[model samples]
Target: MKDSDSPRRRWWHVDPGGALGGLLLAVLSATPSLLPRAALFQGLITAVAFAVGYGVGTAAWLGIRRLVPMRSRPILWIAYGVLWLVAVGALSVLAVAWQNEVRRAVEMPPLDAVDLAGFLLGFLPVVVILIAVGKLNRRVFRALQRMSGTPVALLGTLTALIAGIAATVLVVMFGVDAVYKGLNGAPDAEAVEPSSEFRSAGAGSAIRWEDLGRHGSAFIGGGPTASEITALTGVEAKDPIRVYAGLESAETPEARAQLVVDELERTGAFDRSVLVVATTTGSGWLEAQTVDAIEYLHAGDTAIAAMQYAYTPSWVSFLFDPDAPVESARALFDAVEERWSRLPADDRPELIVYGLSLGAHGGQAVFDGLGDLRSRADGAMFVGSPNGSALWRTLQGARDPGSPVWQPVLADGREVRWISRAGDESLLPGPWSEPRVLYLQHATDPVTWLTPELIWSPPEWLDPSQRADDVSPEMRWIPVVTAVQVGIDMLGGEAVPARHGHNFGDVVTTGWREVAGDAGLDQAAVDRIQEEIEGYAPIQPYLE
Candidate 1:
């Protein structure tokens, strides 16, 4: 044995006990997963296996020390570093892959910045365990050397139990909140069939109150089904269709668009489809999508349970680089066009484009980006549009400033109906002469008045115009809170955003019948909607 003052003993020595402790810490960090039967089990098992392998590796290090008898320690440290890198890196990559696969299989919405926060924090236990175990192992080893017959086995067992309990407690306490929030964050159901068993479901006239609740608890909200939105639009089998929706604060166009796709599938009316791209500013419109879906909510299920997927490439961040969104929107449109392009080429599908707020601005961007592609589509509609008077701004750069070829008039000379809502002056008049545009105004919405955050933009064309000015900062808080209270009163487990909006959507949908009939759109299919809309009499101003 070397002298007590030797450099190896004092500073440069390797501690096998410390290595064992580090390995134990890794295994302990991964062990609790066995109880949950999570999809992460394979990755966790692999990590534990790596830890055991690392502990066994210490024997190789000892053998090297005895055989080579080298004074320099560089090789040993390098080997250890390489081992750690390979083992830890493999585990990390596997964990991410496993997580992504499982999440995708269920069509879980993309995790927002807030959702990942707990996963980010889960690293703390490993650091703490490594520190505690290192010190404890060193002290225990020193004691063994000083004593005659110290029970090393007992010491190792105690260390493992301590590490295991610490890791379990920390992971459980910190991880549970995040996991629950993540699972609950997405809208609940993919669809709801109200007529089946939910014939009598809804809150009583009395106002109840509560806040957040667990998944099945009588207090949460969800997204709506495609059927509900279609029912609300009241688009008869024959009339042209217009779709209006928004991107959630935490949802993307891709995710929300999935719901739209499902709606189209159910309607079987997408022989021609128009896309109204939006910039990110008016993402609040996604709430309208939720409302559309909610109209079909049932008593026992949450609203969002009916939603199939969330939209993606959310407009909020897409607004950062206006050009970037233009490119992406163009690509999306092109892909959609291509999907429909080959079907009966001679009889081309009539296509149009329009959007309002962020979508309107973004739609303009898409037009500018596409150049010739705009001509491919037939007509467009914009509400609360952002394009200026210039042709480039208005027509997505499709029409030239002085093009006589594009007539802006109808045969009978009524306006072409380029309806502008919410008083957006930036959406100037078309240079095209004589009735090429129509303006739809809501007196309450301040965005048209350029009021900053003072009013809520109407959630949908169907929402009561009176509610547009509901600018309470707490509007965001009310839905979640109201859902809980309303859900309990209704005897439902939890109310989703989609479910809560059901009444709103139902009122809007059923009311459309009157709107169509008054407009002389009365047909057999549209009678139900017209009667509902006419009955309310309250939503008239908003509809008009």
Candidate 2:
């Protein structure tokens, strides 16, 4: 072949093999993930998948070229291009059908013509821009290599790469730190003095209202009132004790935990029938469903204590200050456990632990393992736990042979029971044990499934035979594409309707009842409390 016609001579242009690979993977990216994705998000996933596939294909082609001459007739190349286009069109149609199947499974509206247009419009520009950027970076690296002498070319390239990475890291670090500080320092509109002495930071409380921060104030102010609980349960109820220590409440985690214990004592929480150590999400947000359900179930004779560790949202904390939740949860639990342990075992109120999402991950960190968790608290309820939690992973891995990963049955459900919906507890066999640990996880919740391993391997939840009923049967796992799609799914996981994705909703009432082993709560009472909780508006709306 002439030099102009040689494949090596056209290295600057988009290689046919790479483009073909990119198209194939990009099309496959449209397949259903853990949750139904928005058109724009799907487009982004497709663009990312294309970039990854193109890189892999380019490398493979380069390797093959070294072993054999890359030569093809003009007609053969044209025919291959035509076949690729046909494949793309065929796969695109399948992609739409698969997405609609996922939507139907989740009770979401099907994708229409506008969605298709949106996906195409979103995908084309992003993919083209990413390709352009990749080419520009490659050209810049090549130019740098050429400028250096042949003897020092490798060293020059290494130095440039290191410098570029270091500069990027520094910029990101400074930018993130600035954003964190701004958020942490901003004044909360809801942090006002409470009129009732029953609440933390209220009339007679030592903790200041201004120190409660946004989420802390909301948590302290929210939940069913004594009258509301009495009306719903038809039994006179005591005012539920809610104690919180915000980030500004004390300087350190230890101090904050101690303050919470003090506030709990001041509110006579220990005298209540149930005392709960409720771990807060990154912004110190507590799920109303979890706490309210337990309170109403016990006829408002409950005390719930929580503390803030980070000012940012859970995702931000997961990325930047991953250890914050764990540390805070450990401190608060240890303090409460110590204080509760000192009281007369026969007279002391039942100690329970509760958390949702990142809060669940944090709450699990308080114990060494399953044995420790069982021994420490009377019962524990962790909702939408992230896959990274060690205790959760251990229990899940130790699940009985026949159980599914989405709703694992641990040890015949003697101690640990995984609840996906309202009546999942009924599916458990054998006698129920004290200190029951319940994990409330939806099959389609990406937060509970997304992990780094997803980039290379399929999770047990994707096993064909053991898949949960809520997950679409058509959903197939594709290595890197699956990881990206699921990660994106986490962004809007909680926005979906209750019982799907990360929104556990009122199903938590069942989880609380099972974990608490409240025999007094019949189906009617549970339904009433759930209904009341569902209708009640939150003092502050915060995402899990």
- C-alpha lDDT values of all predictions: 0.33, 0.81
Q: For model 1, what is the alpha-carbon lDDT of residue 268?
A: 38
Kindly provide the TM-score of model 2 when superposed on the true structure, using C-alpha atoms.
0.88
- Candidate 1 global TM-score: 0.30
- Segments of candidate 2 deviating more than 4 angstroms: 1-15, 55-73, 151-154, 180-193, 451-457, 517-523, 534-543
- The candidate that wins on lDDT is 2
Model 1 stretches astray by more than 4 angstroms: 1-185, 188-328, 345-349, 369-374, 387-416, 420-445, 448-544
lDDT of 1 by residue, 228-343 (tens): 42354443222222222222211444444443334333333344322222222221222233122113211111111111111222222232334434443454455445544655
* Candidate 2 positional error at 221, Å: 3.2
What count of clashes does model 1 give?
Answer: 47
TM-score of each: 0.30, 0.88
